[model samples]
Target: MVRERKYLGAETNAPVSIICNCCCKRCARKRQRRCLPPEIIFNILLHLPALVIRDVMRHVCREWNLMIRSPYFIHHHLRNSIGGIIIQPLFLAGKSTYVVMRRGCLEISEFDCGFAYAIRTSCNGLTLIPDSRDIYTLYVINPLMKQRTALPPFPHTVDIHSEFKLAFVEASMEYKVVNARGPKPLNPPKQIAMLTIGVDRVWRHIDVQHLPLTARTALTTFPLVTGGYVHWIGETFVLTLSAETETFCEFPMPQLERGFRKFLPMDGNLSVVYCSNELSRDVWEMDSETGEWTMLLSFDLKPLLHRFKDLFSNEKSVTYLGWLAVREVLVLSTICFQRHCIAYNVKTGEIQSFELGTDCSNTKPKVYNFVAHKNSLVCLEGGF
Candidate 1:
């Protein structure tokens, strides 16, 4: 059936002009009544998939050029997709550090810290630090969003020599920093130090009449989906603190041939990395349910040593490392050696490399540290 066309001003309208096929009989009236302007067209294109929208609107007009470049559009795209992971290069100047977001990648605002030693993410945003110095003075920050909050200092006097690790416990929604120091005293030890975040007060010292320290100790906090927990690694013992109860309990470390140990959080589970007697690298995951350790990945460093002789032999070769799961892939970074970065697809076992340099001109890669958060990837630029 043929229907009469409607026009914007129809009282005395002559035959409506047929401009294009898009202006079919039904749409002809609406088109005549209100022609689609560039703004409307741009908005409609924004709702489409990125590739499809780009392909169709590339020839649409000039107005979209500015709209697409606008921060609103950029942020909208970034927030909707798995945004980019950003790593700031340490020691270089010209080559700026960058972040990879869905819309595209961008550089982080410049800071005076030579290289970031640690990176973290929170509900508020991301935080980067050059090193662990006075725990009392550290501040958490989100570089991309330019937001920051001064973290409360540790409660007790911490040994400046010991290394520290941080984790966020979701159950309590609090952040905790754990420091591992000297072995237990031959004589009875008098005091023990611990730190907690989001507490109204600073760190508080507890008497250690019952706690036994060992030759090699480690402190780490893990964020489990149900709740977060903190662990203290002694030479042969493991102490776990439940975030919900704020109580500590003892557990045993797997009897593995451990020379040196490193800890990381992976897939809501605790991961331990160490060098075996075979001088190969081995990774283990802790099963919270059974409290048993399961070996995940073992690699022959001998092959890597031969291939990257210069890197492996360097005194700066990274010793301590952590892994972050990004889009079903595991990204690893080290601190002992010069900045060495690698990623592995857990399922496929495919490996990729990341290069970090101080400046754009530095062909030699440097090392850095990295951490993943809810919405962003953060890396500490430079060797620690």
Candidate 2:
């Protein structure tokens, strides 16, 4: 379905036209002769993918463009959008560039960012790019819309590992930029910074001294955002923060031997992937209300070892990307410098693997999509 574009940031050389079955120019001519009814056009376009609506359909004519940009259309389009794995090269200020889908399907796109910034996290289709050189500067951007809203710089210093995340708070009916990561665990910052998307040009400081979890930040784990809550998975305990209440909660992680444990959002609940060794990995689901853990399934990756024997790094590492709730689990893993990802069909026990194509000779720090991305015409400043 996405043959026109290459995976992992390669652009489609051919132009796309979503108007009728004709090319863009031909469709324009047809439009001039006898335009369709606005109601018909709106209904027809709503069924099309967000990428098509954003990149091709909206450019068909002024009338279509106006309709696509309307708040109602964007709102409904987002509601209908399921979103997918969005990957963009984490380019440092002095580094090269790359791109992917802002949301929905398996399409990736390239756009003009004007300058370089590594994408740290994304929520509800909007990506949060934290400036590498400037610890204080953060950009909340809609890659599809090619628009951005930069958060004012922080007044003081932040930990090098101070990670940032973009999240939506259902209770408040607002979006927020959260930086709960603090300095070295032993000397944690007394307050964490958060900014309400549209209303705050400046960050609102919240006291963290009283938080249930220790002052430690997610040094290595990428926090998971779901159900208006931010969860940080650690070896011993799980730390959670409520975006709405500005409160923190901690719970014990399942007691298992030391292994690589990652928290994934599965079927509206928190799922855990634990790999005790290179041979097998177990997946578990947690019930937040009762603090109970359920064993979902286990993936015996050992049988698939030869598939990556020549490439897998020391850890034989497997990083969970995202998943299709109905069937598959997508994960990123493999090779020394280059990247490889796989999608496992749980029902069929099929492991479909592909390369993300890092194409490097040596290893270095890199970033990938921490969550499924959605594409939106949402204007951060406008609070849409």
Best by TM-score: 2
Cα-based RMSD of the predictions, in order?
10.6, 11.3
CA lDDT, candidate 2, residue 193: 79
**Candidate 1 wrong stretches, greater than 4 Å:** 1-7, 10-136, 152-166, 172-208, 215-227, 258-261, 277-280, 288-290, 300-320, 326-337, 345-347, 360-367, 370-384
- List clashing residue pairs in candidate 2: 83-104, 100-108, 101-108
Tens digits of lDDT, candidate 1, 125-172: 344343345443655554543444555555444434223345555555
The candidate scoring highest on lDDT is: 2
Which lDDT tens digits does candidate 2 get at residues 1-384?
333434423353443333223455787788677977789888888778766787789888788888887878877777666555544454432232222222222333344444465565667667776655675677778876677877777655655423677667755668887775555434555777788877887778888666544525442355776646677776677777778877777778787887677677653357877886676777877765344777777767654555666655444554566664322554545433324555555545656655554545645645543345555667665532
Q: What TM-score number comes out for model 1?
A: 0.54
| Model 1 global lDDT (CA atoms, 0 to 1) | 0.47
- C-alpha root-mean-square deviation, candidate 1: 10.6
Q: Cα deviation of 281 in candidate 1 (Å)? A: 3.7
lDDT of 2 at 333: 57
